[model samples]
Target: MKEWSVLLLSLTAAAFVLFAGAGTASAADGGKILIAYFSRADENYQVGYVEKGNTQVLAEAVAEATGGELFRIETERPYPKEYRETTEVAKREQNEGARPKLKSTPPDIGFYDVIFLGYPNWWGDMPMAVYTFLESYGSGAFAGKRIIPFCTAAGSGLSGTVGTIGKLCPGATVNNAFTMLGAEAQEFSDGTRAKVREWLVGTGLVK
Candidate 1:
């Protein structure tokens, strides 16, 4: 009887390992999509309104359903802890072509088939850390990779950001990006989640 119990536990463990391995393989194939985003705790603008930290909340929801890894792009030079002060710093960085160094790197980005890039729109474009990230990785590691970009901001839509990414990573495939007003992010609701599911299905990242 004791022997039988041990055998049952061993079998259960083995089954779990096999199941997990299969899941990873499917995700590695057409089902895998990675989420890489940068969000600041200080300040943001949304649909001609002002807000703070909406992009971070949105990314968490997206990653939950997809079961994808989330990497926050942090800068070596931290932005001001105060919102007003941070806004001033951001404006200055925008004035100069600034690429604040990132302190953290994505863990083994080579594992995913598709990449979902997210960020809050700043100065009608992506934050400089994004530029730093792209330039650091270059077009080699991501060559032929399918990229999906999603962002939140004030009234400014994706605008020149996509164009700029095109210029930066010349050889990658980019899909039509989505821009959500940061202030509206709290209302993502069930409908917004459904839209994300639709996107995953369209990208062949889900069954």
Candidate 2:
């Protein structure tokens, strides 16, 4: 009876360690994640007028899968409700390399180890307001952090924004970006969620 009890106790201890190690490995790969995105609603391309932006929907899916905090990057001056006008404004901002002012103070980015940056691809690049958000945290905030880029666009996909982010944050690791059509993201369908989950698994952020 005593020998049987000892064997049972040893098995239980070994099982506990094995499961604990597996959990630790998953956490180490994911770390602390933040889903930071810049999204705009109202008369967006493909998805006409919407209450929620496409990129916002995608970011929310990412947040759900990874259990990451969501941060919306907003501008002090809101963009035009009209799609054409917004495009023109975005183009002009890009042309002049403008950094639009942020609406609210950003959270302390130093607490997070992984930043999942999402945005709408505007004129083959990230919106200028995102530029403001990235730089707002100071030059060293993103140092040694892992940045995962995601975007929603009409057809441009990620364009050259991935490379741009790598250049902007010299010390950060910019991973391959994930992108989807704005219309698809706006719909927020089961397929969209599945795709997001698969992508998260590939990144080792989800099991």
Candidate 3:
């Protein structure tokens, strides 16, 4: 009976070690998350008079859904407050391939394992400020991290921004991209959160 008891104890200890190892493995595989976005708050298309930028609203939704830290990418020189003026400036920047100086950057950028990059589609591409932010990180800065792109657009969806990001952040894993209409994001009360949640689930970022 004593020998049997010792045998049972040994088995129990082995099971506990196996279970603990499995839990540790799962934790190691689960990466830290960050939501970085460049958003505009003034005039926008489709949705009139919004206090928050369309991409900002969606980025907030993603942060809420995933419990990721939020980082706003700001430009050193603020863009024109008026929508039309902003569009012109954006167009000029894109045409010139100008990288506007970023006012702020992600905190401890290298610490985050998964980065959710959000921005508004400007003239069928991501805003120039976003490009500045990406370039600020330098080459191979996002080497081993996972990048998930999300965007808000009036009509043009994504506009090949995913490929652009892949090119910018060489060696980084760019996952599936999500694009939501500007109107949907602004009129969030009209099932915007639901759509964001659905996309998060689809991305396997949330249950």
Candidate 4:
């Protein structure tokens, strides 16, 4: 009986040490960055598909700045190709609180320590696909990771989407967000790059 108790005590001590070590690793040295973004590539508002989506451009910049892994949060069923049609559908989804099915997820999702979540502002909210990603692994999907939001919008800068993320990802360490105009992203690459770099540095995720 005494021997079993000693073994159990040793196991408990080992688990505590391991848990403490993981906590320290989470905030250490930009810790395994993951840049996850949802972008639409077809006919967009004002900016036609010149090759890439506005949010995609920002996602790439974030990956470059932080050496983060990129994960595109895509829908299994595609959205409408026309901008107006897509917006109409988006509105309905937002009203219904829809969770569209996703195409895929990162194989090593739990390995990421800092996640930079990017999306376009849709009806003052994130794409329904983004919610799918957040809820994919059940509750606490973003637990123990620092979540930094970046977004592109024509006018509605973030539109309180960051707060919505906090609601979705209950235990996530959600931080202040970065917002850029979609038109500016398409028209001014240099300026957008500078802004992305500045935001990454300000977040202390990149030097």
Give me the overall lDDT of model 2. Answer: 0.86
- The digit string of per-residue lDDT tens for model 2 on 1-207 reads 999999999999876543223332124677788889999999999788999999998888777667788999999999999999999999999999999999988889888888999999999999999999888877777889999999999998999999999888879999957999999998878787677766777776666
TM-score of each: 0.75, 0.85, 0.84, 0.83
Regions of candidate 2 where Cα sits further than 4 Å from its true position: 1-29
- Per-residue alpha-carbon lDDT of candidate 1 for residues 60-146, written as tens digits (9 for 90 to 100): 765665667777888988876566677777778888989888898755656767677888887777888888888887457777777
Give per-residue CA lDDT, model 4, range 1-207, as digits (tens): 999999999999876543223322124676887889999988888987556788998888676556677999998899888899999999999999999988886446688888889999999989999988887777777788789999999999898898989998878999959999998876656666667666766787665
Q: Which candidate has the highest TM-score of all? A: 2
The candidate scoring highest on lDDT is 2
Each prediction's Cα lDDT score? 0.71, 0.86, 0.83, 0.81
Candidate 3: minimum summed lDDT over ten consecutive residues — where? 18-27
Cα error, residue 169 of model 4, in Å, equals: 1.1
The reply for model 4, stretches above 4 Å from the true place, is 1-28
Q: Quickly count the clashes in candidate 1.
A: 1
Clashing pairs in 2: none
Better of 1 and 3 by TM-score: 3
